[model samples]
Target: MTVAVEFIVNQLKQVLLEEQVSTNETVRQLHGKDESHHALSLPDIVVFPRSTADVSAILKIAHVERVPVVPFGVGSSLEGNAIPIAHGISIDFSEMNAILEIRPDDLLVKVQPGVTRSQLNKELKKHGLQFTVDPGADATLGGMAATNASGTTAVRYGVMRDQVRDLEVVLSDGSVIHTGNLAAKSSSGYHLNGLFVGSEGTLGCFTELTLQVYGIPEFVTAGRAIFGTVADAVSAVTALLQAGIAIGRVELVDEDSIQQANIYNETAFAEKPTLFLEFHGNEAGMQEDIAFTEAIFEDFNCLSVEFEQDNAARNKLWEARHSLAYAYIHAYPGKKLMSTDVCVPISKLAETISYAREQLDIAELAGGIVGHVGDGNFHALLMLNPNDPQEQAKADHFNEQIVQYALLRGGTCTGEHGVGIGKMKYQSTEHGAALAAMKSIKTALDPYNIMNPGKIFT
Candidate 1:
């Protein structure tokens, strides 16, 4: 083991500075795992690559050495997307974090993969622009793109894959390629940007990324509508969407999730199923939308609707929804979070959520259902005792039922989490022959199967 370490370290140091390549146990452990319950596997070494050239060099050496390479960001991925199961070399991209350019004219921004979505939003705000994808983790843009992540705002803005215009990737053979052109819309070859954005580092490492940005809306309204039941809340969303409400963000926080939020944050939210809504438009149009939504809310048995006129209040209103994950972690100390995400068609939203709730209850799983319901996507946040196999099985059973329900209703296994290690078991069941096509693509690109192996596929 030390002999392999000695040879690799010497070669890596020749390309990167000795300090940039680390073999410290603490460092290796840090790079090995993500924020998931999956068993941790330590990388033999962690390499910090600052530029595309640095990444290319590392890939070249690793490819020649037949060593696996895992591209890491902030380790915010809920699935085991970033974990190094093969324990080869972990290339941490945090040092490459940079906003390279902001083209206001084209509504585009160029950035290195390591920059966080929040960081980009801050810079974009100065120019009256915003990066629309909000995965809610302040996650590195690369990881967000890798997971094809979305959040509350995705109802209107879209997922990370939708915002990407171009990607500068370092292939497994150490060759560099641009997966996309900077054009707004392209009818060109293969749409490699889409292929790579959710590849979860199995295809290549994203060195630089170009994304579309949006101008800040003139009037942004945020609110929460309390409903008699989760079905009512979901139905109201579907009604509003059908009515063409032009809603920006719409989320569902169940009563139990609200209870957890209230307990953790010391806030008073109605102990009922709720729909957190937001609309982006001019004042008059927003007022029209508000009235229309209110009328629809009443039709769906909404108990109360409260709107936040100011930014601070809007952020405060969204606090409960954003804090749901942390609240669960806080509620069950030492237990790991196993959030299950499944998306169904809009027509099946209410039934899908209701089914998840009923299944969780019947299974006696410690979980709550919360989601970006407007997108027909939701997560069952299940807290599992790390040491208890029976409890873990309950959580797994609950998750499987949810997936089965969604799949039967023409839904995919995961909406935004991508095909991480956690979801690999569902790939064959979910994609069938298409999964073989994906594996073929993976083979064509990485051939060596060294790029984040044991992820996507078993």
Candidate 2:
């Protein structure tokens, strides 16, 4: 072990319980990588903190020793957000998994960093409530907030940043502070809540989060509309958004992705470019909304539209949509998943997706296209043989092409996936001078640069 890591571990052991720390090869390897294609580089040690006070102590010692500290949340992140690149200590928060408070009347829940989205939803169901952010993996709420994650439902409910009312953060200098309060809206000083939500743990570690939740929709409906081409499908969604259709979730699954989902899920969905849509509202209002939505789908020559009104069918339809990324991952056992996401304006959706298709063909890469088209954010799931450097290069080229298309059209490099190591190259091109301002913020907050080093900027 390195001198720095040994010193930090020795000091931390004095305050942390014996079971709370580990240097076992198996444990270090487990915390070394996330779901991304990034290679694993194990940290020297892994520590589990059970509460905010424990986190505060860990940070205090790491800061004094100048040992880099990486915060881990189940390691389900798509980007390399949780990877401990600096060979120091990886703080796994699974032991802190707790639902601290559930306020049914206020539509809020206070949870620890390790609490996963599915776990929160299961609990919320008892109160006739739910957390709306649904990233593909059952990622932790803190990880979701760090990466500013959103999924199929973001078209209506918004991203993780939108749901986080407050964050109890532990800074590099061992200070504990809450970003905001429980109030529904705040015009208060400097929006710290927004600052910490998508910071990717660069500025500090999120210890606790008070999130906004929603009551169950009185009625729901889902539909699968197939189109002859991606252009036609994207254009139809554009028309629906233009006509003010309030879709709870509208997803686009391409032909290749549909085939993969069918194989993994064992359900016979048509292998066509399809748009999976859902509607939420009062029982009396949904019928009219569904009718109007169907008419728009027709205007763009929807090949066929299938609606699922029963709860079981609707849930099953969404299950297929949610499982798409995993299906692609499952298709190739040994290949690493290089999942890249980008967002463009609603109008440019068709061409951006078409350009992605062209790039995939040019690179001769067998990639899957799936997206939440209600907004213009989508992912290109590329499977790369980790052993082949040439194949990895081709995947990189494909990602560059798609990102260039989005940035040229005033779109973001990432919509929900935060700028981790994978997206660092495009940050300057995407943010320009604003990126330097972000650097200033980083320097002022974590001047040591010990918090998740080699991320975001370098």
lDDT of 1 by residue, 139-218 (tens): 99999988899988898988988999999999998999998877889887898988998899999999999999999999
Q: For model 2, how does the per-residue alpha-carbon lDDT over 1-458 read when each residue is reduced to its tens digit? A: 76866777788889999899899999999999998888798999899998899999999988887878899998988778889888788999999999999999999999999999999999999999999999878999999999999999999999999999999999998999999999999898999999898898898999899999999999888989999999899999999988887889999999999999899889899999999988999977888888888888888889999999998888888888888777877898887788889999999999999999888888887678889888899998898899999999999988988999999999999988888888999999999999999999999989888899988888
State the lDDT at 72 in candidate 2: 92
lDDT (C-alpha, whole model) for all candidates: 0.91, 0.90
Q: Where is model 2 more than 4 Å wrong at Cα? A: none
Best by TM-score: 1
Query: Which stretches in model 1 have alpha-carbon errors above 4 Å?
Result: none
Per-prediction TM-score: 0.99, 0.98
